[model samples]
Target chain A: MFDGITPQLLFGQLLIGVINGSFYAMLAMGLAIIFGLMHVVNFAHGAQYMLGAFVAWLLLSTFGVPYWGALILAPLVVAIFGIAMERLILKPIANLDHLYSLLVTYAATLVIEGLIRQQYGSTGLPYSSPLPGGVNLGFMFMPWYRLWVVVFSVVTCLATWLLIEHTKLGAYLRAANESPEVVESFGINVPRMMTLTYGFGVGLAGLSGVLAAPIYQVSPSMGSSLMITIFAVVVIGGMGSIAGAILTGYTLGIVEGLTKVFYPEAANLVIFFIMLLALIFRPSGLFSGTEKS
Target chain B: MLDDTTAPLLEVRDLRAWYAESQALQGVTFDVRPGELVTLIGRNGAGKTTTLRSIMGIVKNRKGSIRFEGNELIGRRTFQIARLGLAYCPEERGIFSSLSVRENLTLPPHLKSGGMSDEELLKAFPNLRARAGSRGTSLSGGEQQMLAIARILRNGCRFLLLDEPSEGLAPVIVKEIGAQLRRLKAQGYTILLVEQNLNFARSVADRHVVIEHGAVVDQLSNEDLAADMDRVKTYLGV
Candidate 1:
């Protein structure tokens, strides 16, 4: 069973795992934040990710812009879209049950995916790797752009964690989640905070899309397939714990990668299997210390 | 400690408040002088909570005028009302379960001017200091109540609208809370407390206002309260 195992191959798979982990970490972080603070499952996350990739592709292909510029401009563009969705779509139903939010976000996802499909078609568009070449690390060859994705995502995750956990604004965000009325009584505008948090959460998904575009083929449905796996990661990690989501994402990615090496047939089903096990043993997920919202 | 010369700290006139389509308070009127301990006593469904919520602008369907230091509160948001020197502690205690005792006490965004410090909170409820690192959910019910009050005081709101601060607490803890309220009053803070516990109300309140069917049924000072048991029983259903 272990005859084909090699350091070079293992290292390559590890790099791939890390790259996949980066996306998982970013996406799960967003889902966890939105679900935890705002109590919305944000089913539109996948569509938002797809939208970010599309925006980058559109800017690069339509206007002859560079990938470097697309990286910054695309996420900002997607963030604005997210803000619009929060203000116009989600705000009205903020007081309603979580199912309403889920339904609304699901509808939004459908509309977004449909519009993009209409404009761009279902074919996967090619995007040339802007940061070409790789570094040979003796045991494994690491592509420069893949390494960039990992570094960039780590930075993004850490920054988000710091913003939510360390700062005064973060304190307000947490306070609002705990008791909106009490936070309001403390002179903090909770509605504004809700809008910004939704924007920020969706913005993370958008950022991940930009990072993912060069690695995967850009298409309308790019985020849809990945969204299911990320959701599994969230469930396995827990929806309310940000650090838990990120850690579970990266860890599960590695575990999945290892499974791919040992038994390629089991690679796709590994996350789901783990999720089933977790649900049976710890329905609240690995790091969910308390009952979920 | 409320001086007759100073303007009223909180004034409500013909206030109407509701929950969804059901009206909870109708044409309620009252005033809280600065540095006064005013108690609102009534049966469970008599709109005591609604009156407090309306004054804090927590109720969505509310009408009539509420003035805190001469500022209109009818259209203001709860946080804005709080920023204007009003704090509300609901009957549920509203402790942040994820946060520790110290974090819960210090979590409010804006600190009130001349509010109690962490040292003061620890002194007022020393048990909180002993359990500063413990999560809010892990604390006993009485400890949670103490944490809630300590949190609001730390946030620095001068005018407190405390809803049933004594409900469900142990007798010893209720006494501690009463002592703290008296201390807060002596420090020149204005309090409007809504309580079902008559003994708790009698311990700290300077005056009592009873509500029945959302309207003011009676008002009495501590002197009158000492002599009038029948009125208390009738209005408060005690």
Candidate 2:
């Protein structure tokens, strides 16, 4: 089964896996944060990711902004859009059942996708490789931007982990997760925290989108399809945990990459199949400390 | 003695509160003086929890005045009420099972007046020190209750509304909790405790109030409560 797998091809696939993993890690990290604390499984996350890419494309094509500026501006722009959704759409339904949040967000996703499709058309828009060189790593040739994506994503994930786990705001967030009433007593406004947390999570999706624009063609449907795979990663990782999302995202991506080398037909189905197995064996996901909250 | 010169720390007048369509507290009235340990004794569903919930503004569809140190509590959010120096420990013991005992204790946001330092908080509850690194779910039930109380203490709230601190705990742990209540009282913290255990109520309550079917049935000092066991049994079914 492994006879035809060359080191060069394997290394190339691994590089691809790591890139995919970076996106998976970033997107799933956002999903876990929102779902865990706010109890909102934002179906709009993928649409936000797509919007991030579009924002970057628009900035570059229409305004002649550089890639560096789009990297920062696109996420901020998308994050504001996310905040708007939280305030106008999600906040009213905050007290309703979790299913309503899912339904509302799904509706929002459809609306966003439709609007983008209307403007951008269905054909994939090409984003020129902003960093136009590669480093030869003996077994594999690594694009500088791809390497930058991997490095930047790792830093983002680590920063997020520290923010949630080590900082004062993170403490309140965890406290809110435990007992919002007790946290409220301390005079930390919880609803405001919820709004910001949702925005931040959506911001993470947006960041992933911008990073991915240079790698793949910028398209409205990009985030919609990617979300399914990321959801599988979240399932295998568990929704209640941050580290679980990050680790599972990268691990599953590598597993899928390996599957492509060994059994090409199974590559697409690998993550979903692993999610099923995870549900059966460890329903809480790999790093999830407990069952559902 | 109830403070007469200054307004009561908490005043609830004609407070009507409900859960969805079910009226839990109807025209409830009470006053809790500063530095007092008050107990609300009632059978299950006597609106004991509802009264506390109303004060915290957690109750939906509430009408009436809940003035905490003179601020209107009716429209304030639960977090705002809490920031106003009131802490509510629910009956469910909402511990963050994923966090360590120490992390759970330290996770609350800081307060301006100052909360207990981790060192002092641990000194106050040595049992917690032993289980500081343990996950919240790994601790025993009694330990969890201790952790819950310790959590508020660490947050440094001066007023506390505890719902059934002694429920489902071992008698030894109940006595331990009773001791902590006395210590908290001596430190000048005002507490409104909802309890079913008459003995636990008698141990630390400076004054006692009884509720039946959403109304105040009786109010008495600890001395009067000890003297009138027959009436207590009749009202509380002790």
Candidate 3:
């Protein structure tokens, strides 16, 4: 195996790894943010991601919307859908146990996936790449679309981090996460903040879905397939740590890619294995100090 | 003693609250006039904290009237009550671990005019000025208590509900807090403090309302509280 391994193979896998990591980072970040405020695991994240891709596909097929248009519209549409879910379903049950939220969102995932499957079928649909080009780096050819995905995801994640960490709005979010009652007593509308926060978190999932469509193919089951891994990524990163989610997502993605190159059979199992290790060694997560209990 | 002729800044009439089926505040009644530092004194489980919480609208399963500035506070949300210029400083201090001292200081947006400016607040609480960049939780207990009060002061709230500000402080620090409360009262701020420290309460408060089994069992001015120290101590079971 070592004899056959080359720089071309390694760098190609590395790029692929980074690309996977980008999706992981973006999706996990959304989950972390939602959980941070609402204490809801948002089991419907997979369905939301799937919805993003389907929305983009529908826009292109039905209204002749281009990739650029879908990139902006898909997340907004998903955000609206997420807002409705929160207000109508999540909000009423908010005062109940966390288990109720988890169950409700899981049911939502099933419902959304079922609706899409009935409409579009189980088979994957192709989404034409918007960039449609590549750059030769001597060792391997890197597609412009893949490069865009990585850059866009990184920028999106960075922007979110800044919004939550540096701004007054972010201070409200952080304070709300700590003690919503205290924050509300300070005259900040916490319920409204929670609604908007849920919208924003799922919107990130939609953005990730849009970015993933051309590469992964739009399908009902796409999100469910990735959901387990994303959850594992979240657990390994820590339950509610923003930085943990972003950093672990990218790190684990690369780790999986490296496994694919070195031991192809173990690639899929790698993330779960790390999650198991993290649970045993650091149950609160690797980067949970900054987040609420 | 000040005249009791004017309208009360806050009037709690038959304010009953419950945590699930267990009742906390039962027919508790009180009045804090404008510019007065009123203290709610009781033993543990006497519902002093619950009274403050019910007033802030933090306890939803509550009955009766909480009128602030003559507006009914019952049936309103916590934020709505806060927007009405009422702020609560909880027993836990309720500081955010994620926010820096500066962020925590400026976190609550000013609901009305007359809130202290950043310079004025930092000047008033000099320890906060020095640890402006530190995480809110990183501060010492006294500093955290000070920050809790300081945050609410910036929100333009003339009426404050502070719960146990000197619960775990050194005597020196407790003296400092008492001084701060006196200064705040002199500046025309009205306070409703929940305290088990009768000595501290007598030092800072204009009047003391004693609660027993969730009802307003007694009221005393500072002189009366001093004269009736043994009886007050007996009421507190300490």
Candidate 4:
């Protein structure tokens, strides 16, 4: 089984693994951040991701906005929508059970995805890669767009981690997760902070969507498939653990990719097998800790 | 309404709050003048914590008139009440386990430079200064209480609402906390403390407002408390 495997095959899968890992990191980090702060599952997250890609596609197809401009604008637009959803829908029920948010967001997801499907008829749309070229490293071929995505995702994730762990504003966000009433009593508007935090988390997913548009088809169903994988990533990571979410995301993606190389049949099922093993051994996750910086 | 020229620094009138179907506070009323230290004393479930929480506007389902420095605080949000110079240190101490002592000290936004500067706060809390880089929850109980108080002091709130500052401290630490409060009062900071420890309250507080089953049963100045210790004790059930 190992005799026929070449460097091209090995590194190519690893490259694919890294790219998938980057998306996993972004999506799971967003989910973890939102849940850590407010305990909302945010089922509409996939819809938000889809909306980001759709918004970018629309900007290009209808308004003649270039990919670079869409990359900047799409995430912002989706974040604004998230903020509005938080204010009008999620905020009122925030104090209720954690399951309420999950249900509401689930309903919201259906409505959003249905609206897009109704217009586009569920067919995939093509998005030309902005960086349409590749480099031949002596061992493996590398697409500039894939490399860009990997670098950009890593940068964004690290920036977010630093912001939450090192900055004063991040300190407040983490504090609020522990005791929102106390934070509010400290002259910080905790409710407003909650709203903004939710928006920011959703924005991260939107950013991932913009990045995904070129790789995956710009269809409403795109987010749903990836979101399922991200949910598994988040669960294997742990509840509300930022470090766990990030580390598990990339590791699992790579593991899945490797499974594809050696045993093609097990690629799809590999992540769940790992998740089951992790649950039996370390249910809290490999990087689980109290909601800490 | 006729007292428009001046109002109490902190005032509450007929404040009622409920948690779901259970009523926590039933028409509690109290006031604290500037440059004074007031303590609220009661047995557990007597609504002492609820009263402080009500004044902070954290109890959402509440009907009351809470006036701070002539400003109506009833309908205002918690952060709004805080920005108006009211700080609440909850009974649990509300320490952020994730943040370092230094981060916790600086987490609250300073509305103005009034109570104490960061350096002054650190100087006052020697333990906090020593363990500045440690997580907020790593401190001892007494130290955590001191850090909780110190965090608010550096936050620029002139009026402080502290719930059970001396609840679980040693007699010596209680004395130290009492002394610290006295010093804060000397610097013209008004404090409303909820106390389970009668001796600590009798030592530091200028006055004691006794709560019995969610209402103000009695108000005693230091002399009054000293004269009638038994009655205050009966009210406190300690």
Candidate 5:
């Protein structure tokens, strides 16, 4: 392994790992927020992500919208769809057991994916990079778009963190997560808050999809393929923990990336293996302490 | 300072509530005036808490009327009812564990114009000021109870429904809470309190409503309560 490994290869893999980590972090944060507030796993997240990519692709091909326009427009469109779905489908079963919600969203995922698959078919569609070209970093050649994805993801994540941790509305979200009834009795509309929270979470996933479209081909199966890994990240981070999800997601992505360099066969299995170990030892989660809101 | 001629600020009439299929409040009826502090005195499981929950719209499957300032509250959501100026401080002292003491204090949005300022609240409860950055759950029992009541006061809600504010506190703390209730009442806040402690009730309340098996069994003035302590004790099964 050492014989074949070069500085360029090591740094190249590291950058790729960070890029993958950014996507993971974004998706996991969304999952955690939705789960924290409504206790809904939002299985439709994957489908919504696929929809984001498709929306971006459609915008460019049909209406001549730029990559910049789709970046904002795609997520907004997906979020609106999410809000409607929450009100029509998720709200009714909100009081039921957690399993009912999971099954319902899982069903929604199938429906959404099936509809997209019907229209777009199984082939991958290309999304041209908005920030094209690369810069030579001494160690490795870095694509501007790839660097943009990492920087954009970090900023988005930081903004979301500030929104939840520092703002008044964030305080409401945190309190409502603990006990919605108590929060409501204080004159806050918890039901509306729930709907918006679902939308926000779904929007984050949509944003992640747009970011991934330039790097990977936009395909229907793209989201579903990544869902398992995201779920594993969420579980290992501890359910409904924002900081935990973000930190664990990046760590797992990097670890998996490094594994590909050292032991190619183990790359795919590493996240699940860690997840299993986490479940066995710290069943609550590796970061349950930070799981408060 | 009891005024019988003044219209009741909150009138609860034959309110019936259920938790799933089991009924909790069965035809419970009472009223609190604009500036009076009333206590609902009952033994455990006599629906004292249920009455408050129904009024606050926490118990969803509730029937009958809860009129606050002449506005019917039965059809309204909890938040809507709260917006109409009724605030609840629950028995469990619903301080969000995830929030800091400061966050907990400012959690509820102001519903009216007369809420106590933050400076005033801090002056009133110095412990809260000291633990402003501390997580709400880190507080002691008395501190948690104080934080619960303090949060509601910031909302400027005139009518307050407080359940067991003194239940798990020390004697000194109970007295302090009683003093706070008196001050609120003097400042024109109407309160409907649920209590198992008759002494606590007698200390701050102008009137008492005795509940038994989810209905109002008897009503008494402060004078009537003082004159008939033994009978009231028996009525409460104390």
Candidate 6:
């Protein structure tokens, strides 16, 4: 049964799976952070991600900006929009139940997606790779752009992890999630932190969007499709654990790829299948702690 | 004690607060001068905790005035009120369980320049130094209580609103907490504590303001408390 599959085929699919995992780690991390800190389910996360890619596309097509500039500009612009959205839109309903926030953010997705669709339409836009070369690594043709994505995502995730786990600012963030009332009573501006943390989380989604734009089509619908996978990753990883989401992202991605190798029909369903098992076994997620933001 | 020439450090007047439709504090008024230790004493559901929360701005549905250091406090957020040199140690000992003991101590920012240094605080709460690397919640109840108070001390918050410091603690720990509070008072710290433990209150506080059904029913100096013990016992039912 294994005779037909070559090393190249196995390694190639694994590389793609890891690439998908990178996006999952980034987007799901943002979702986890937003949910953990603000209790906002942030259905607009995928939409915000789509906006990142669109921002990159718009910058290129409208202003003749290159990929390098959009890479820096796109996430920043989307992060600003996220901060404003948090301040003006999300803050009003922040005191309400989690369900209300989830509904609001879900509604926001439709509105944002609708407006972008009105401008860009349903047709997918293509983005040329910034790095065009590939390195042949025995069995796999490793694209430089793919390598860059992995490196960038790892660095971004590491930086974010260090920021939240090690730094003074991170300690405040963790403490706030544990008890915001106590944090505020200690003289920290928690409301402002919520707004900024929400922005930072969405900005992560936006960064993934910029990364995703080059690999996938830059369409309004792109995030909607990927969001289902990322949410599955978040659930399996646990709702608020930072490292859980990242580790689960790559693990499930590889599992999905492996499923494709062994049984093609189960490829799409593999993640949900694993999530179901995880829910039954570890309802609190793989990592168990009343832990960090 | 040095002469208190200035106005009272905190003045809360007619502060009515609610938890949704249920009223918690109704026209509650109190004052704390510099270097004073005041306690709000009451039974359960007597709004003792509510008064502390209202002062911290944790209870948002509050009406009337809360003036700290001559600055209006009712409309301000908790953090801003805290920045005005007020700190609150909650009833449950709100500890960030995931954070190390040291992290919890340093989490609260220093609002003033001159307060207990980390070395001084470690010297004061010597047990905390041993469990410095441990998660905050993993400590014994007494240690957690010590950490809760110690967390705020190094931040230069001259005023503290401590809620139930002796709740669910051993007699030895309670005595320790009492000793610490007296030391803090002697060092010129102002505190407003909420306590169900009448003996603990009697031991540490300079004055006691009694709360009954969310209103200020009585105020007594520690000297007056001995004379009014029967009356106070009736209010507390202990």
| Highest lDDT scorer | 3
Q: Pick the candidate with the highest DockQ.
A: 4
The sequence of per-residue lDDT tens digits that candidate 3 reaches over residues B32-86 is 9999999999899999999999999999999999899889999999999999999
Candidate 2 chain B, run of 10 with poorest lDDT = B106-115
| TM-scores for all predictions | 0.94, 0.94, 0.97, 0.97, 0.98, 0.97
Range of the 10 consecutive residues with the lowest summed lDDT in candidate 1 chain A: A284-293
Model 1 C-alpha lDDT per residue in residues B46-108, reported as the tens digit of each score? 999989888888887899898888999999888788888888888998887766677787877
Ranking the candidates on DockQ from highest down gives 4, 5, 6, 3, 1, 2
Best by TM-score: 5
In candidate 4, which residue pairs clash? Answer: none
Q: List the pairs of residues colliding in candidate 6.
A: none
Candidate 2 lDDT by residue in tens digits, A58-101: 99999999789999999999888998899999999988998999
Q: How accurate locally, in lDDT, is each candidate?
A: 0.86, 0.87, 0.93, 0.89, 0.90, 0.89
Clashing residue pairs found in predicted model 2? A184-B79, A185-B82
Q: In candidate 5, what are the lDDT values of residues B97-151, reduced to their tens digit?
A: 8889999998888789999888888988888999999999999999999999998
lDDT of 5 at B207: 94
Predicted candidate 5, C-alpha RMSD = 1.1
Q: Report clash pairs, candidate 5.
A: none
Off by over 4 Å in 6: A290-293, B1-6
DockQ score of each predicted structure, in the order shown: 0.57, 0.52, 0.71, 0.86, 0.83, 0.80
Candidate 5's displacement at residue A79, Å, is 0.6
Judging by lDDT, tell me the better candidate of 1 and 5. Answer: 5
* Residue-by-residue lDDT tens digits, candidate 3, A42-135: 9999999999999999999999999999999999999999999999999999989989999999999999999999988999999999999899
Sliding window of 10 residues with minimal summed lDDT for model 6 chain B? B1-10
